[model samples]
Target: MPPEPPDTDPGRLLAELIAIDSVNPDLVPGGGGEAAIAGFCGAWLAARGFEVHRLEKRPGRPSLVAVARGTGGGRSLILNGHLDTVSLADYDGDPLDPCIRDGRMYGRGAFDMKGGIAAMMVAAARATAHGPLRGDVILACVADEEHASSGTEEVLESFTADAAVVTEPSHLEVTLAHKGFAWFDVEIEGRAAHGSRPELGIDAIAKAGHFLVALEELAQRLAQGPAHPLLGTGTVHASVIRGGEEPSTYPAHCRITLERRTVPGESADSVERELTAVLDRLAATVPDFHYRLARGLHREPFAADPEALIVRTLARHAEQTLGHPPAVRAEAFWTDCALLDRAGIPCLLFGVDGAGAHAATEYVDLASLDRVTDILTATIADFCS
Candidate 1:
């Protein structure tokens, strides 16, 4: 392996980054947001000769865009990573302190993605070190990925690139696809009555149970249906359910919040149609199946062209770095890659290997971090030039 750069060494940059509290407040209230961390990243990029731009979509959340300008004959490239992380409420160790044990750096955002951010930052700087490229290399360090991803959405309002790479931790693989999701809340209505008058009271919770049973059947059907080549079958499950006020009185209403994970072809509208069909069948069979399905948030799934120049460039560099072709696969989770793809930027997801995101103990593999940095450095140079 080549000697690591001192100023932007993956481990050191990640440790310094992890030391700053940049938890997304929207996910868990009172936790630090991305303002301070964005500032730190902005300054770091500025020192490396990037033209930095700071943006704040909301009051507290901020995102930084650092551009290494080029001579304007080649395709522009965007290296993107989120700044905000999930809450650190129940973490086992000090979530901020970077602990190096067994060559892994443990911290709150260690695996889930500060490692990717560090790698991309260093890689961008290294790509532009020798001389300016023929096209710009943009590093978009955005905020609120753990929640709504408002940061990336805001940045996309004005920024455009020929191709983009979201450093979203795919075990250092070139992730070409991933699942999207739609959230919905089904409210079941019932009549309240005293416990003594069982005949008069309608049990909303009990009715909800029937819906859950039907949902299980739906899940079974989904499993039996056609699957994506890489993503497998899409699925659904109840996330939060609430009903009943007291043991004595039957609950007047029940609310079940569900998330439907959609593959490439499935969308929120299609998913809603699936749920509506199930509900329609239930309403026909079950007595008084009074319910309302309210739509929540929906994020589109991402699928990149394997033959795209950016994908080919990264894959070639990855094979050279690993001595084998990097595995291309799909992720079960969503990322800002979809947003970029939607904005006409063909993007792929790639990042370092690690474990335990938003879990008890989080760490990023040190070796994998360096490998990702090296590969991305080469990829940035090749794609932009």
Candidate 2:
């Protein structure tokens, strides 16, 4: 294919990416995940003469790594974003439909972040067309970000970069750090018996109620203390619970799912241990009140070095392009940046301006999209020059 246009308008690319549904592994029912978006990115990058590598962690879920070679003197800069989005499966409207209204792009991943991916793509294309760069530009569009970051983990296992940028929805600001998350399911076991003979059996539902109270206390304590400078301390909340089976019979078992946010310097293992200790203490009170804890989703907190070259370069570019100095912030939610950071890459988060991520009728401002593209292009030039 003839070399793709140098000035690859990001708007067109955003529309194309939004049209592809690459919902994450957890969100997808049958586990076929992120393949469509990966295919589109791979094809698009390859057609633009980039050296593209496609990796699959599972069948039909692929991640793409595209490289533009330069003078090869300095370390490579990794421009990363996930292809998978939070499932729109629950959405009543068509998730794949990309709508433009009043200069805004309305779609499932419009802001968080097909828009960011489009900016990266356009920046890479522009840099390639401008001739050889001083350093390599690596574009990593991965799968499973909305779930467990399997694709990012795969990248971390095999690849290393000097610095990295994760294109999450940061409202065009620099995100130097973010809190991690741990999800778990706790099961309390008890004996079941007829309602008329309630004294003959132990009630798991009652035990669960006590445990929930303890969890609430734990959450409150963490919230009031242990605040981090950026990400704050931590948080815990019981998201779901199930116990009783029938009204006529006493329930035998209860399961509660919880989500815990961890700040920097906190480990998922530590959080699990703390929770287990709480359960053990409760078990001492009730002999048959034993509970088992199983971890589900676990991600560590990530904080990029504020003085890293990539972060500084991007901040400067944002100021130049948008005429305002980018403010550094922390996200309460988690992203694949944690995976990359653990892999020893300094990862900063930045993206287009938007709101209502993962909510209905998600939209991204057209002006923000344009500004992101311009800033990204300039950052790439600055880094590779």
Candidate 3:
């Protein structure tokens, strides 16, 4: 069970969160997991009179969902934020030590995005301050966003709402779309022979060089094909390559991994087809060219309807709070909002300002955190009540 809500300032709550190491184990072996933080958040919500449910799809990996039960009369809203952060590999100072300087709270997961979690948590508490809500407000503090996103993936199996807001760092803008990425591994096979025997050996590395050239051509063609108004054209790039053992011997195999950042219209199948076309052309001309293409991980691109109910509602509230409309922008990184949107939740991304997530130093803008909390609090009251 989660502990009782601690009597502390909102910024201090964020500091406490930063002090806890919820680094994704997938990113850093033996890194602290989300169980402790999830428990704390769940308890905090429970203390605020929410119905808390602890979900653990994988062993030791937990996500907390706290719901304020409603009369089933108004619209339900989901506030989603992940609990895991990347490894602190090269951090300049102690990544877990939270400090305040120049009106910024500096620490790991502070900006990207314990600050958002703190804001949403406080907002939920304040929304129900007067009385019970007409509609349910679900607080989804999940795990595993940094690596596989298995936490949100697991939650989507059952939990849902009319709309959702992912509190990912967005510089306080409304992020309506983001690029998705797919990883593909290509293997080229050739006959091994002594390097001196050029006629007897088929060079797989040389063949890969041809594919690299073709990849550039494919990139050019893709850049010229079409573009998303917000996301622009898709992109493809070679990630890593491995082949050859000794200089005296012709390596029998070459393996290459490539990544494709997809825009709205692209899919894994489409990407595979495009790569197959490249290999097909090479096969027609290059002698002894044999290879196989295998698809790895893929996350679909997300694009929210700018006119969505959640979008309009958040915008109105944000404008009322900021004295101007929040900018609607696109993100280069992906978020769990894509999964929520795919499940018909009409979710959008929003968060505070700061930088240096997974970097040497990190922090969240203290003022932005307070502003986001106030905006979200008012938004919940207006939309759910």
Candidate 4:
């Protein structure tokens, strides 16, 4: 028999969350979706007096929005945390088994980011236990953050909040900004002919080398460019490449899929233009070079006003909880905070301290989990009141 759900204690809540397999199916074939975990969370919230709403726009892929309605007029706050995790196959031990040792909880999603999810869950319950605040406290346990973030995307379509906090394991620090990403495909065209007839065939694979070299040059140029105060400069690199099928015949096409990590000022359009310029230059300089650049998925970078009400409130609580000012930091990776910010909801990221986000080993500091819970509870009370 499975273990029962824990009480309001953040550490126990985190353990229960870790024990549930909420791996993103989009990332791993036949992986456990958010169904089981979403059900658990929904029941947990419903039992605690939250009006739980389960969103399953995509069948079998559900996201939960649990709300504690406010009594009167006050700014609502959204506490966001993804319910899905990366593949657990590579975990060093039993991925689903939550263990505690040396004041740390070890499990696949313990750190990134069931810890944050548990903290926020307990915090929201605690903050509104006595009575409803003037503003609503909404806890969003969304799906698909590991792959497409379709869960958050769907949530934004129906819900909006005055402010939000993404619990994404930021080492108990305040993360005001994070890098975005843009994907692109560069297909190089070439003439197919027998290998012996070099004169009749244009080698697409060889031509791709030119683009790869140019891409490196572009990366270097980006490195030399002016950097964002926290996020630094944007970066580009080839992620996947497919070319010649066999050595007996000349290949007709070579496709290169690359990803560009962008700072605040950069966008998919900007990155496309940069790639276009590089390709155009190569076309003009390299002989028989023909190619097409196609833009793929993209997400915008996020930057929060350090002076925003939510930021200040959370930071103050965090400082009080830690007995020291929480350091303001930035992440190179993307998060749902970007989506919330783009939707005009002011948001920042703050969560428990941990390591091994997608590595073979993972763990979250038990003390930090409790501290984060205290910080979030205080912040929610102060901000929503």
Give RMSD to native, each candidate.
1.2, 2.8, 3.1, 2.8
TM-score of each: 0.98, 0.94, 0.96, 0.98
Candidate 1: list runs displaced more than 4 Å: none
Q: What is the full ranking by lDDT, best candidate first?
A: 4, 1, 3, 2
lDDT of 4 at 11: 86
Cα lDDT tens digits for candidate 1, 202-225: 999988999999998889999999
83-182 in candidate 4: lDDT tens per residue?
9999999999999999999999999999999999999999999899898999999999999999999999999988899999999999999999999999
The global C-alpha lDDT for each of the candidates, from Candidate 1 onward, is 0.92, 0.84, 0.89, 0.94
Clashing pairs in 1: none
Model 3 worst lDDT run, 10 consecutive residues: 1-10
What is the alpha-carbon lDDT for the whole of candidate 1? 0.92
Alpha carbon lDDT at 198, candidate 2: 70
Worst 10 residues of 1 by lDDT: 1-10
Using TM-score as the measure, name the better of candidate 2 and candidate 4: 4
Q: lDDT of model 4 at residue 280?
A: 96
Model 2: per-residue Cα lDDT over 96-154, one tens digit each: 88878898988888988888899888888886775868888899998778777788888
